[model samples]
Target: MAADKPTAEAVAEQLARLREDYQARLPAELAALTALAAGFGGAESDRARLDELHHRLHKLAGSGGTFGFTALSARTRTLEQQSKQWLAGSLDEVEAQAWQSLAAEVAALGETLNKVSPPQAPAILSARDSLTSDETVQIWLVEDDASLAEQLRRQLESFGYTVRHFMQIGDAEAAAHTQRPDMLIMDILFPQQGENATEVLALRPILRALGCPLLFMSSCDDFESRARVARLGAAGYFLKPLDVPRLVNRMTQILDQLRAPPQRVLIVDDDVALAAHYRLVLLAAGMEAEALHEPQAIIETVAAFRPELVLMDLHMPNYSGPELAGVIRQHERWASLPIVYLSAETDLDQQIEAMGRGADDFLTKPISDAQLVAAVRARVDRARQLDAQITRDSLTGLLKHASIKEALEITVTQARRHGKPVTVAMLDIDHFKSVNDTYGHAAGDVVISSVAMLLRQCLRMSDIIGRYGGEEFVAVLPECAGGDAQMLMEDIRRRFAAIAFSYSGQAFSCTLSAGLASTAQYPEFSGAELLVVADEALYAAKRGGRNQIRTASPHPLQEADRP
Candidate 1:
């Protein structure tokens, strides 16, 4: 028989089962330990008994967190340490300390264990799922009123959402069992006037555990009602009657958050095995990860990987982790990149010292797999979200208007310093207003999104592209003249014109006109000046004929200097 390996999901399921078994069996174990402690004698005869009790505490300390009961595990570790001192002939310490302290600690741990909920399998996001950005968002609505449900469904559908309505919580729960929506919109009021659905949901916590972003609307908008929704971790709560447009806008924002690309992580550890292990763990969890075993390659790897977070190992042969973090921070571009130290150093003072040198956080090694994933994911997600707010366009995935301009200015300054050419293209979709007038604004949006997708597909990784407001795109191409940029724009124009868009069963196509200005044509022009020149050429292209590329002429001085 071939050797079989368990899938990650299977491993997580097994771990969950093991964790549940551990939680269920904990109270009995704690009671037994207390029973043994109560009858303890400080004599040789009690050695084995004390050892056994100490052993049990040790096992709980090590295994509790591994099985997901980190609090219980930590408490057990403290008890185990106290017990160890007694078992190793320092029995007076335990006897000196009020026996009540140990008893109280054990009781407190038991209480925590008793309150532990059922173990849930760790959520795993696959590589394909993470890479498939902009997955169509699905929304499930739980509203008993059919008219309101239908109205919201139509409104959401118009915004390209797949909306499902559930008249009863049971139906929604059943649908969730089959297919979980990306988000949920629910009403706290049902047919029963006084029965708030939020209260009912609190009783049945399954919906909350499914982990979709939640939004709730309620006629009762009191503090108590808001507090109840807050406990459920709702993304938004609206007062009824709900504002459809505002709700749709909130839903879109949530969807954008969900559809953002997986965070990229760079692991810098001298131990190749450990780094590779971390990489696999992150990649299997639907993150982009690269590992660097050599400290010398840190800067290069970070530059190429463009990581949202860096996992640094404290001790390395070539340099210290904190020193490396400080080095990375010296580079202005990477100043804010999240750098977390991952090492076996457990001394709080030392960890704090490392963090003082520019590290964001310090996580001791031997952390549980789940804890590691959660830690890194939380950091990377926050870092990326913060970055997106500054660097990304809200409507399209292209660079934000100001960000692209900043990027272009930087590129232009570099080109000037190096005496290299760079091209800036200004593009506008031909007759875009007519598309909105003819079909609808929704159709116009589709056309704009389609063109954005095409540009992303065709642009070089080094090239910079941005959405300069509605139906206008600007792209920066390094080391290319206006002629070359125009050629590239012509190809984009052709490809975009070929994309067939449909609204209400009526198919149509759209095209774009472009203008290109190059540093070669006007060597002294700044990035902003180049943009103005490009925009002028774009208008000329539009006036000459729609759906064409126009290149700006070289400066008269530059033409004479060219010889």
Candidate 2:
């Protein structure tokens, strides 16, 4: 046969598809291989089975090498040789066991190889062509017309615009609770089909609450409809049958105008002279700074300015540094607020105590300007890590339920404050209890730990993964909408299902189901409400079937949204 020729794009797509397919089949393949090897007999019947396995290994080695899966090829080649030896009667019982062990090892390597294959750069490049780093524009299409909604979806997808669509304002409000898209394209004359007008009007407060860039789209651009959209805080108005190209350009311009550099930092100290001194140091370091003398007003000042970092003195009479730290920690909203003690508490014990009491770091009074700046930078970085760990699960290193809730709250607050997008997902292992019962708790541990590790490897570091007790895990993805979060979780679900766990000479496989909900569809709900909705979706996943992800009902009542 002539040497097969495939374009790089074709090969890459084929490889990507193969990786996806192989991940789906990997668990079963490994189980079969493990059982065959472990149960191998010393007669001709066993030889026939061994020959079949050898042929499979040979085929995998050859094809894997051709497909640039070098590690898979190498491991398969080793297995192929071992199988040959076992079949040739040149292998003793020890050699047979070794061959079986090698087969299992090769199977594991094959799973890894599937993930390591480089994703198709061309596909990413093509996707990127539709989006620009400079653009921050997004659109929401609220239409009962499914055709129009889908048409707009395709058009926006082609333009690389983030788009969300809903038939009812209730659904839209629910999505906006977590995600605040850049714009809203609404149908003015919604055919009030058994939906309450008050409920519909309630969506306006939710949209306004999100503070997102908004636009209205309606077939009937009547004065009443325009007036309603205006009251909803819309920025632009457009009639249905929108000019896609013109809309894109206009959105790009609006987003460009909104982009700006980072904000300034201000440190308030009761010592007036010291405050001014710190301000000058911060200014020299190229940051905007202000000094305030009143310790009591730090909270109000910070709330207004929203500075990224704060430094406080420990020795203040009325508001001690530790007390101030406690206040900041209690703010539930800014619990992760970085507070560094800048007092002259030189005692080693005091420094440790301050840190233990929520102070990110402590510096002796009369600190150097250089030391101040460096300490601020270092503590800010550490605060981020600690924030992550506090929310993450200890056993699986995923997010804990509390952390997931915190993240969702932050996302909702941010969207209501700055119009950013957010997504929440709940994951649960399928029939997990059965695994524990059949394989023993130790094997169950392996499965849970393995799944957690795989989830960490699969998701971006920016994404938050948390254990929600039992076999359930939750992920909070900032800057992502429901569709994208669902896809990512599904990929994780599939990869997790394909992984095999071996213990006590037996091998088993596992699967997961996930529920995805985003703020894009429901903009008015709180973070707590969004989590309930996501959890409800998880229940749907469990009900529909295991090993799948389900999107929650867009208009689920608040009380009914929870499990």
Per-model TM-score, in order, reads: 0.46, 0.38
Q: How do the residues 1-563 of candidate 1 rate in per-residue lDDT, one tens digit apiece?
A: 53356676687788888877876687678766655554343334345556777898898788887886776788789888977876776553443123434544664465445335533322322221232212345688999889988877865554456688999887887655434666888998777545577887788877876678999998886999899899888899997666544565566567656545566788899899989999889866766677888787778877766788999988889899999998899899999999999878656776878878899988888878788899999998788778777888766678978988999999999889878899999889999999999999987877776666566546654588899879999999987775577777887877677555667767687889988889998899999999998898888788887888888776664324221
For residues 410-491, write the lDDT of model 2, one tens digit per residue.
7678766768777788788899999999988877766676666555545554566778788877777777886687777777
Superposition TM-score, candidate 1 onto the true structure: 0.46
- Worst window of 10 by summed lDDT in candidate 1: 125-134
- Residue 360 Cα positional deviation in candidate 1, in Å, after optimal superposition: 5.7
Every model's Cα RMSD, please? 19.9, 30.9
lDDT of 1: 0.75
Q: How far out, in Å, is residue 397 in model 2?
A: 4.3
